[model samples]
Target: MELKQIIQNRRSVFPDQYNSKPISKQVIMELLEAANWAPTHKRTEPWRFKVLEGETKINLGVFLAEKFKETADKFSEFKYNKIKRNSKNAGAIIAICMERDPEESIPEWEEVAATAMAVQNMWLTATDLGLGAYWSSPGLIASIGEFFTLKPNEKCLGFLFLGYYDGPNPERTPNPIEDKVEWL
Candidate 1:
Protein backbone atom coordinates (compact mmCIF):
# COMPACT_ATOMS: atom_id res chain seq x y z
CA MET A 1 0.00 0.00 0.00
CA GLU A 2 1.13 3.53 -0.64
CA LEU A 3 2.28 5.48 2.43
CA LYS A 4 -0.51 8.03 2.09
CA GLN A 5 -3.18 5.39 1.73
CA ILE A 6 -1.93 3.47 4.74
CA ILE A 7 -1.67 6.60 6.84
CA GLN A 8 -5.11 7.83 5.88
CA ASN A 9 -6.78 4.45 6.27
CA ARG A 10 -5.32 3.73 9.69
CA ARG A 11 -8.00 3.87 12.37
CA SER A 12 -8.24 2.85 15.99
CA VAL A 13 -10.13 -0.44 15.77
CA PHE A 14 -11.24 -1.70 19.15
CA PRO A 15 -11.38 -5.32 20.26
CA ASP A 16 -15.18 -5.36 20.03
CA GLN A 17 -14.82 -4.89 16.28
CA TYR A 18 -12.31 -7.71 15.89
CA ASN A 19 -13.03 -11.16 14.59
CA SER A 20 -11.78 -14.35 16.24
CA LYS A 21 -9.17 -14.85 13.54
CA PRO A 22 -5.70 -14.79 15.04
CA ILE A 23 -2.76 -12.74 13.85
CA SER A 24 0.20 -14.92 12.89
CA LYS A 25 3.52 -14.61 14.69
CA GLN A 26 5.24 -13.71 11.44
CA VAL A 27 2.99 -10.69 10.99
CA ILE A 28 3.50 -9.63 14.57
CA MET A 29 7.24 -9.82 14.00
CA GLU A 30 6.88 -7.70 10.90
CA LEU A 31 5.07 -5.00 12.88
CA LEU A 32 7.79 -5.05 15.50
CA GLU A 33 10.48 -4.80 12.84
CA ALA A 34 8.71 -1.74 11.47
CA ALA A 35 8.61 -0.24 14.94
CA ASN A 36 12.34 -0.84 15.34
CA TRP A 37 12.97 1.45 12.42
CA ALA A 38 11.16 4.43 13.97
CA PRO A 39 13.20 7.61 14.39
CA THR A 40 15.04 7.94 17.68
CA HIS A 41 17.12 10.85 18.85
CA LYS A 42 20.63 10.29 20.24
CA ARG A 43 20.35 6.59 19.25
CA THR A 44 18.20 5.81 22.30
CA GLU A 45 15.81 3.31 20.83
CA PRO A 46 13.38 3.71 23.70
CA TRP A 47 10.52 1.56 22.49
CA ARG A 48 10.22 -1.86 24.11
CA PHE A 49 7.37 -4.32 23.63
CA LYS A 50 6.10 -7.26 25.68
CA VAL A 51 3.75 -9.37 23.62
CA LEU A 52 0.93 -11.14 25.46
CA GLU A 53 -1.07 -13.95 23.91
CA GLY A 54 -2.87 -17.11 25.05
CA GLU A 55 -2.78 -17.60 28.80
CA THR A 56 -0.67 -14.50 29.28
CA LYS A 57 -3.34 -12.34 27.67
CA ILE A 58 -6.02 -13.82 29.88
CA ASN A 59 -3.91 -13.25 32.94
CA LEU A 60 -3.39 -9.61 32.05
CA GLY A 61 -7.14 -9.03 31.83
CA VAL A 62 -7.77 -10.69 35.16
CA PHE A 63 -4.99 -8.72 36.76
CA LEU A 64 -6.24 -5.42 35.36
CA ALA A 65 -9.85 -6.02 36.43
CA GLU A 66 -8.76 -6.82 39.93
CA LYS A 67 -6.46 -3.83 40.07
CA PHE A 68 -9.18 -1.49 38.86
CA LYS A 69 -11.59 -2.71 41.49
CA GLU A 70 -8.97 -2.28 44.16
CA THR A 71 -7.96 1.21 43.08
CA ALA A 72 -10.94 3.18 41.75
CA ASP A 73 -12.50 5.62 44.20
CA LYS A 74 -15.94 4.51 43.05
CA PHE A 75 -15.66 1.42 40.96
CA SER A 76 -18.10 0.71 38.16
CA GLU A 77 -18.53 -2.91 37.22
CA PHE A 78 -19.15 -1.89 33.62
CA LYS A 79 -15.74 -0.28 33.21
CA TYR A 80 -14.04 -3.17 34.97
CA ASN A 81 -15.70 -5.74 32.73
CA LYS A 82 -14.96 -3.74 29.61
CA ILE A 83 -11.26 -3.62 30.43
CA LYS A 84 -11.17 -7.35 31.04
CA ARG A 85 -13.20 -8.18 27.97
CA ASN A 86 -11.13 -6.04 25.67
CA SER A 87 -7.95 -7.76 26.77
CA LYS A 88 -9.45 -11.19 26.28
CA ASN A 89 -10.82 -10.32 22.86
CA ALA A 90 -7.59 -9.03 21.37
CA GLY A 91 -5.54 -11.52 19.34
CA ALA A 92 -2.52 -10.19 21.22
CA ILE A 93 -1.70 -7.37 23.59
CA ILE A 94 1.64 -5.60 23.35
CA ALA A 95 2.84 -3.68 26.36
CA ILE A 96 4.39 -0.48 25.03
CA CYS A 97 7.30 0.63 27.17
CA MET A 98 10.19 3.04 27.05
CA GLU A 99 13.53 3.07 28.80
CA ARG A 100 14.66 6.59 29.55
CA ASP A 101 18.20 7.66 28.89
CA PRO A 102 20.05 7.09 32.14
CA GLU A 103 22.53 9.83 31.40
CA GLU A 104 19.74 12.26 30.45
CA SER A 105 21.27 12.74 27.04
CA ILE A 106 17.94 14.02 25.67
CA PRO A 107 14.78 15.44 27.18
CA GLU A 108 12.40 12.81 28.48
CA TRP A 109 9.62 14.01 26.17
CA GLU A 110 11.80 13.18 23.15
CA GLU A 111 12.00 9.59 24.28
CA VAL A 112 8.24 9.48 24.74
CA ALA A 113 7.71 10.96 21.26
CA ALA A 114 10.06 8.39 19.75
CA THR A 115 8.22 5.58 21.50
CA ALA A 116 4.94 6.93 20.14
CA MET A 117 6.40 7.06 16.63
CA ALA A 118 7.25 3.39 16.97
CA VAL A 119 3.64 2.61 17.79
CA GLN A 120 2.53 4.69 14.80
CA ASN A 121 4.75 2.52 12.60
CA MET A 122 3.08 -0.57 13.97
CA TRP A 123 -0.36 0.96 13.47
CA LEU A 124 0.38 1.74 9.82
CA THR A 125 1.71 -1.74 9.25
CA ALA A 126 -1.42 -3.25 10.80
CA THR A 127 -3.58 -1.12 8.53
CA ASP A 128 -1.64 -2.22 5.45
CA LEU A 129 -2.19 -5.85 6.49
CA GLY A 130 -5.96 -5.32 6.94
CA LEU A 131 -5.79 -5.78 10.70
CA GLY A 132 -7.18 -3.87 13.65
CA ALA A 133 -5.02 -2.29 16.30
CA TYR A 134 -5.56 0.13 19.17
CA TRP A 135 -3.21 1.86 21.56
CA SER A 136 -4.95 2.21 24.93
CA SER A 137 -3.57 4.25 27.77
CA PRO A 138 -5.50 3.83 30.96
CA GLY A 139 -4.95 5.46 34.31
CA LEU A 140 -4.22 1.95 35.48
CA ILE A 141 -1.10 1.93 33.35
CA ALA A 142 0.67 3.54 36.30
CA SER A 143 0.19 0.28 38.19
CA ILE A 144 1.23 -1.96 35.32
CA GLY A 145 3.98 -3.35 37.51
CA GLU A 146 1.40 -5.81 38.79
CA PHE A 147 1.23 -7.33 35.34
CA PHE A 148 4.67 -6.68 33.78
CA THR A 149 7.94 -5.74 35.35
CA LEU A 150 9.98 -2.75 34.24
CA LYS A 151 13.62 -1.82 34.75
CA PRO A 152 14.56 1.25 36.79
CA ASN A 153 14.38 3.47 33.74
CA GLU A 154 11.60 1.68 31.96
CA LYS A 155 7.94 2.69 32.14
CA CYS A 156 4.74 1.49 30.60
CA LEU A 157 3.31 3.83 27.97
CA GLY A 158 0.23 1.79 27.15
CA PHE A 159 -0.88 -1.42 25.45
CA LEU A 160 -1.38 -2.10 21.75
CA PHE A 161 -4.27 -4.46 21.14
CA LEU A 162 -3.96 -6.08 17.72
CA GLY A 163 -6.34 -8.44 16.01
CA TYR A 164 -8.20 -9.31 12.77
CA TYR A 165 -11.72 -8.09 12.13
CA ASP A 166 -14.52 -9.03 9.72
CA GLY A 167 -15.88 -5.55 9.11
CA PRO A 168 -14.68 -3.23 6.37
CA ASN A 169 -12.82 -0.06 7.24
CA PRO A 170 -15.33 2.58 8.26
CA GLU A 171 -15.36 5.79 6.25
CA ARG A 172 -13.65 8.68 7.93
CA THR A 173 -12.50 12.17 7.01
CA PRO A 174 -10.44 14.66 8.92
CA ASN A 175 -10.66 18.44 8.59
CA PRO A 176 -8.28 19.92 6.06
CA ILE A 177 -4.70 19.94 7.36
CA GLU A 178 -4.33 23.53 6.24
CA ASP A 179 -6.78 24.60 8.95
CA LYS A 180 -4.15 23.90 11.62
CA VAL A 181 -1.06 25.12 9.83
CA GLU A 182 0.26 28.66 9.40
CA TRP A 183 3.08 29.11 6.91
CA LEU A 184 5.73 31.65 7.77
Candidate 2:
Protein backbone atom coordinates (compact mmCIF):
# COMPACT_ATOMS: atom_id res chain seq x y z
CA MET A 1 0.00 0.00 0.00
CA GLU A 2 1.06 3.61 -0.56
CA LEU A 3 2.53 5.40 2.44
CA LYS A 4 -0.36 7.85 2.61
CA GLN A 5 -2.89 5.04 2.50
CA ILE A 6 -1.04 3.12 5.22
CA ILE A 7 -1.04 6.11 7.54
CA GLN A 8 -4.76 6.58 7.02
CA ASN A 9 -5.44 2.90 7.56
CA ARG A 10 -3.78 2.55 10.95
CA ARG A 11 -5.94 1.75 13.99
CA SER A 12 -5.48 1.15 17.70
CA VAL A 13 -6.53 -2.44 18.24
CA PHE A 14 -6.56 -3.96 21.72
CA PRO A 15 -7.81 -7.41 22.72
CA ASP A 16 -5.94 -8.33 19.56
CA GLN A 17 -5.23 -11.90 18.70
CA TYR A 18 -1.48 -12.04 19.04
CA ASN A 19 -0.63 -15.25 17.25
CA SER A 20 2.39 -17.35 18.12
CA LYS A 21 3.89 -16.63 14.69
CA PRO A 22 6.98 -14.47 14.83
CA ILE A 23 7.81 -11.41 12.78
CA SER A 24 11.06 -11.07 10.88
CA LYS A 25 13.83 -9.07 12.53
CA GLN A 26 14.33 -7.13 9.30
CA VAL A 27 10.75 -5.85 9.47
CA ILE A 28 11.21 -4.87 13.10
CA MET A 29 14.33 -2.91 12.23
CA GLU A 30 12.50 -1.13 9.43
CA LEU A 31 9.77 0.00 11.83
CA LEU A 32 12.30 1.32 14.32
CA GLU A 33 14.04 3.17 11.53
CA ALA A 34 10.80 4.95 10.76
CA ALA A 35 10.61 6.03 14.43
CA ASN A 36 14.17 7.33 14.26
CA TRP A 37 13.17 9.82 11.57
CA ALA A 38 10.58 11.64 13.69
CA PRO A 39 10.99 15.44 13.92
CA THR A 40 12.78 16.80 16.99
CA HIS A 41 13.73 20.12 18.56
CA LYS A 42 17.42 21.10 18.78
CA ARG A 43 18.03 17.56 17.49
CA THR A 44 17.71 16.24 21.08
CA GLU A 45 16.19 13.05 19.55
CA PRO A 46 15.10 11.87 23.00
CA TRP A 47 13.63 8.49 22.09
CA ARG A 48 14.86 5.40 23.91
CA PHE A 49 13.58 1.85 23.32
CA LYS A 50 13.83 -1.49 25.11
CA VAL A 51 12.74 -4.47 22.98
CA LEU A 52 11.13 -7.34 24.91
CA GLU A 53 10.59 -10.84 23.52
CA GLY A 54 10.63 -14.52 24.49
CA GLU A 55 11.54 -15.04 28.14
CA THR A 56 11.81 -11.29 28.67
CA LYS A 57 8.09 -10.95 27.81
CA ILE A 58 7.22 -13.38 30.58
CA ASN A 59 9.39 -11.46 33.03
CA LEU A 60 7.55 -8.24 32.20
CA GLY A 61 4.21 -9.98 32.78
CA VAL A 62 5.32 -11.08 36.24
CA PHE A 63 6.53 -7.60 37.07
CA LEU A 64 3.25 -6.04 35.88
CA ALA A 65 1.32 -8.61 37.94
CA GLU A 66 3.23 -7.61 41.05
CA LYS A 67 2.93 -3.90 40.37
CA PHE A 68 -0.84 -3.92 39.87
CA LYS A 69 -1.36 -6.08 42.93
CA GLU A 70 -0.26 -3.19 45.13
CA THR A 71 -3.28 -1.07 44.18
CA ALA A 72 -6.77 -1.35 45.80
CA ASP A 73 -8.69 -1.68 42.51
CA LYS A 74 -7.74 -5.31 42.86
CA PHE A 75 -7.48 -6.75 39.36
CA SER A 76 -8.36 -10.41 39.53
CA GLU A 77 -5.81 -13.20 39.19
CA PHE A 78 -7.59 -14.20 35.95
CA LYS A 79 -7.34 -10.71 34.44
CA TYR A 80 -3.76 -10.46 35.66
CA ASN A 81 -2.95 -13.80 34.08
CA LYS A 82 -4.53 -12.73 30.79
CA ILE A 83 -2.16 -9.80 30.50
CA LYS A 84 0.75 -12.07 31.38
CA ARG A 85 -0.27 -14.63 28.79
CA ASN A 86 -1.12 -12.12 26.04
CA SER A 87 2.17 -10.29 26.55
CA LYS A 88 4.06 -13.48 25.84
CA ASN A 89 2.13 -14.05 22.62
CA ALA A 90 3.22 -10.74 21.14
CA GLY A 91 6.13 -10.90 18.69
CA ALA A 92 7.89 -7.97 20.31
CA ILE A 93 7.28 -5.33 22.97
CA ILE A 94 8.95 -1.95 22.61
CA ALA A 95 9.24 0.36 25.60
CA ILE A 96 9.37 3.96 24.41
CA CYS A 97 10.99 6.51 26.72
CA MET A 98 12.62 9.92 26.79
CA GLU A 99 15.84 11.20 28.34
CA ARG A 100 15.44 14.64 29.89
CA ASP A 101 17.77 17.37 28.73
CA PRO A 102 19.24 19.65 31.40
CA GLU A 103 21.40 21.88 29.24
CA GLU A 104 18.86 22.72 26.57
CA SER A 105 16.45 25.60 26.94
CA ILE A 106 13.53 23.65 25.47
CA PRO A 107 10.83 22.50 27.88
CA GLU A 108 10.78 18.86 29.06
CA TRP A 109 7.25 18.37 27.70
CA GLU A 110 8.45 18.93 24.14
CA GLU A 111 10.99 16.15 24.48
CA VAL A 112 8.25 13.75 25.52
CA ALA A 113 6.05 15.04 22.74
CA ALA A 114 8.79 14.34 20.23
CA THR A 115 9.13 10.83 21.57
CA ALA A 116 5.38 10.36 21.16
CA MET A 117 5.60 11.50 17.55
CA ALA A 118 8.29 8.90 16.99
CA VAL A 119 5.92 6.25 18.34
CA GLN A 120 3.30 7.37 15.82
CA ASN A 121 5.83 6.84 13.08
CA MET A 122 6.45 3.35 14.41
CA TRP A 123 2.75 2.54 14.52
CA LEU A 124 2.23 3.82 11.00
CA THR A 125 5.14 1.82 9.69
CA ALA A 126 3.83 -1.31 11.39
CA THR A 127 0.52 -0.77 9.65
CA ASP A 128 2.26 -0.41 6.32
CA LEU A 129 3.88 -3.75 6.96
CA GLY A 130 0.53 -5.42 7.69
CA LEU A 131 1.37 -5.91 11.35
CA GLY A 132 -0.92 -5.36 14.31
CA ALA A 133 0.42 -2.92 16.87
CA TYR A 134 -1.00 -1.65 20.14
CA TRP A 135 0.43 1.11 22.30
CA SER A 136 -0.25 0.54 26.00
CA SER A 137 0.66 2.78 28.94
CA PRO A 138 0.02 0.20 31.65
CA GLY A 139 0.03 3.21 33.98
CA LEU A 140 0.02 1.07 37.07
CA ILE A 141 3.49 -0.18 36.18
CA ALA A 142 4.71 2.99 34.48
CA SER A 143 3.63 5.52 37.13
CA ILE A 144 6.59 4.74 39.39
CA GLY A 145 8.88 5.22 36.35
CA GLU A 146 11.95 4.90 38.57
CA PHE A 147 11.32 1.17 38.79
CA PHE A 148 12.50 0.83 35.19
CA THR A 149 15.97 2.00 36.32
CA LEU A 150 15.99 4.75 33.73
CA LYS A 151 19.01 7.00 33.63
CA PRO A 152 18.94 9.83 36.16
CA ASN A 153 17.40 12.04 33.48
CA GLU A 154 15.23 9.52 31.68
CA LYS A 155 11.51 8.73 31.96
CA CYS A 156 9.26 6.01 30.62
CA LEU A 157 6.47 7.18 28.36
CA GLY A 158 4.72 4.05 27.03
CA PHE A 159 5.11 0.64 25.41
CA LEU A 160 4.15 -0.67 21.93
CA PHE A 161 2.99 -4.23 21.52
CA LEU A 162 3.77 -5.58 18.01
CA GLY A 163 2.61 -8.77 16.36
CA TYR A 164 0.58 -10.29 13.53
CA TYR A 165 -3.14 -9.51 13.92
CA ASP A 166 -5.53 -12.40 13.47
CA GLY A 167 -8.61 -10.23 12.95
CA PRO A 168 -10.09 -7.77 10.46
CA ASN A 169 -9.11 -4.11 10.36
CA PRO A 170 -12.06 -1.80 10.91
CA GLU A 171 -12.88 1.10 8.60
CA ARG A 172 -12.05 4.64 9.65
CA THR A 173 -14.85 7.05 10.60
CA PRO A 174 -14.08 10.52 9.29
CA ASN A 175 -14.70 13.53 11.52
CA PRO A 176 -15.80 16.85 10.08
CA ILE A 177 -12.81 19.21 9.93
CA GLU A 178 -14.78 22.28 11.03
CA ASP A 179 -15.35 20.79 14.47
CA LYS A 180 -11.63 20.87 15.24
CA VAL A 181 -10.36 23.69 13.02
CA GLU A 182 -10.10 27.26 14.32
CA TRP A 183 -10.52 30.41 12.21
CA LEU A 184 -7.86 32.33 14.11
TM-score of each: 0.97, 0.90
TM-score, prediction 1: 0.97
For this target, which candidate reaches the highest lDDT against the unseen true structure? Answer: 1
Model 2 per-residue lDDT tens digits across residues 137-166: 877655535345778788777778888877
Model 2 stretches astray by more than 4 angstroms: 143-148
Q: Candidate 1 — what's its lDDT?
A: 0.94
Per-residue lDDT, model 2, residue 47, is 94
- What TM-score, to 2 decimals, does candidate 2 have? 0.90
When summed lDDT is taken over every stretch of 10 residues in candidate 1, the lowest stretch is: 163-172
